[model samples]
Target: MLIDTHAHLNAPEFAEDRDEVISRARENGVSTVINIGFNRETIPTCLELAERYEFIYAVIGWHPQDAKDMTDADLEWIAELTRHPKVVGLGEMGLDYYWDTSPKDVQAEVFRKQIRLARELKLPIVIHNRDAHEDVIKILREEKAEEVGGVMHCFSGSWETAKLALEMNFYISFGGPLTFKNAKKPKEVAVQVPLDRLLVETDCPYLTPHPYRGKRNESGYVRLVAEEMANLRGLPYEEMIQITGDNAQRLFRLPARS
Candidate 1:
């Protein structure tokens, strides 16, 4: 079975037929999905979905873009949610220089706080980096994030960056971008990321794979990302599915089959 390690199924894009979307993913061999909570509005919904579905898991944290809105009390709230059995990790957090919705300093502060919280809770983190690779890597290292490593969700970085992340005990996750025709970098990184340190995701409701580009993405489309990765690695599609699924299970500490 394959795993979509990062998704946003709680978004309104899935409101009409959320059940059907998940069923389609199951039909296409995606057995597990890690739904992310990016802000205060979506955290509860994200956890609710995980509670409702045996194969769905939640990663709750604030996004850097919304860093200005999160408060210390909110961190406590996230900690409370972490006690739930289905809440698998923390984040979708990190730097986002591309948007600059929040000041860089504020984003960094929030990111570090979450990193410390994840360490305290003994949970993995799911990072979201955009146009701030250097700062992100710097902060992660300074914060000693390797103690409780996490996945760099929808990674769009150079092989050099990936090498550093792997050394830091983090996994490299490829998403819909891996399937884009012009996405040469992700393909190059896909070929080099070690099997044990590789993961696949859809980041659905965004970054739809080619042939379905510009449309609303769902977990079912993660197969296209996996197929692309398999081709790049010169491995069979099923083997890619198995290895990536295993990677996700190991990172999130889920059951072997889940």
Candidate 2:
């Protein structure tokens, strides 16, 4: 079975048919999914889905774009949510200068706070970075994130950056972008990332793989991403499934022993 380690099943886009989406993912061989919570308002919904679905897990934290709006109480509450049994990670959090939706300092502050929260809880983190490579690496290094390693979700950086993250004891995750014809960087990272440190995600309801590019995404399409990786690495489909599935289970500490 495969796993889409980063998805937003609770997003408003899924409000009308969340059950169908999850069912499709399961029917398509998705054994598990980590539903990431990014806003102050989404934590309850994220956890609710996790509670309802046996294969769903939760990762609670604020997104960098939403950083400017968070309150001290929100951060505190997020820390508290980490106490829940099914919540396994701390973020989809990191630097994003592509849009600069949040001020740099505010984003940095929120990122650091979430890092601290992850450290305190001793849980893995799922990072989202877009066009802010150097600062992201600097912060992860200075913050000493090795204490509790994590994955760089939808990782779009270079082999150098992927190497840096792996050195810091983090996994490299990729999604639909890897299937794009114009995604040179993701393609390079796919070929370079070690099989063990590599992971697959759908980022569903956001980054649908090619052929479904402009359409709304769902966890079931993660198979496309895995197939691309398998073809890129010249490995058999079954081996890719086992390796990537094992990588996800190990990274998220999924219930079953792989």
- Evaluated with lDDT, which candidate comes out highest? 1
Q: Which stretches of candidate 2 lie over 4 Å from their true place?
A: none
Instruction: Estimate the TM-score for candidate 1.
Output: 0.98
Instruction: Report every candidate's CA lDDT.
Output: 0.93, 0.91
Specify the poorest-scoring 10-residue window by lDDT in model 2: 249-258
lDDT of 1 by residue, 1-258 (tens): 889999999999999999999999999988899999988899999989998999999999999999999999999999999999998899989999999689999999999999999999999999999999999999999999999999999999999999989999999999898888899898898889999999999999999998899999999999999998889888999999999988999999997792
Q: Tell how far residue 224 is off in model 1, in angstroms.
A: 0.4
For all the candidates, what are their Cα RMSDs to the real structure?
A: 0.8, 1.1
Sliding window of 10 residues with minimal summed lDDT for model 1: 249-258
Candidate 2 TM-score to native: 0.97
TM-score for all predictions? 0.98, 0.97
> Residue 185 lDDT in model 1?
91
Scored by TM-score, the top model is 1
Clash totals, every prediction: 0, 0
- The segments of candidate 1 whose C-alpha lies over 4 angstroms from its true place after superposition are none
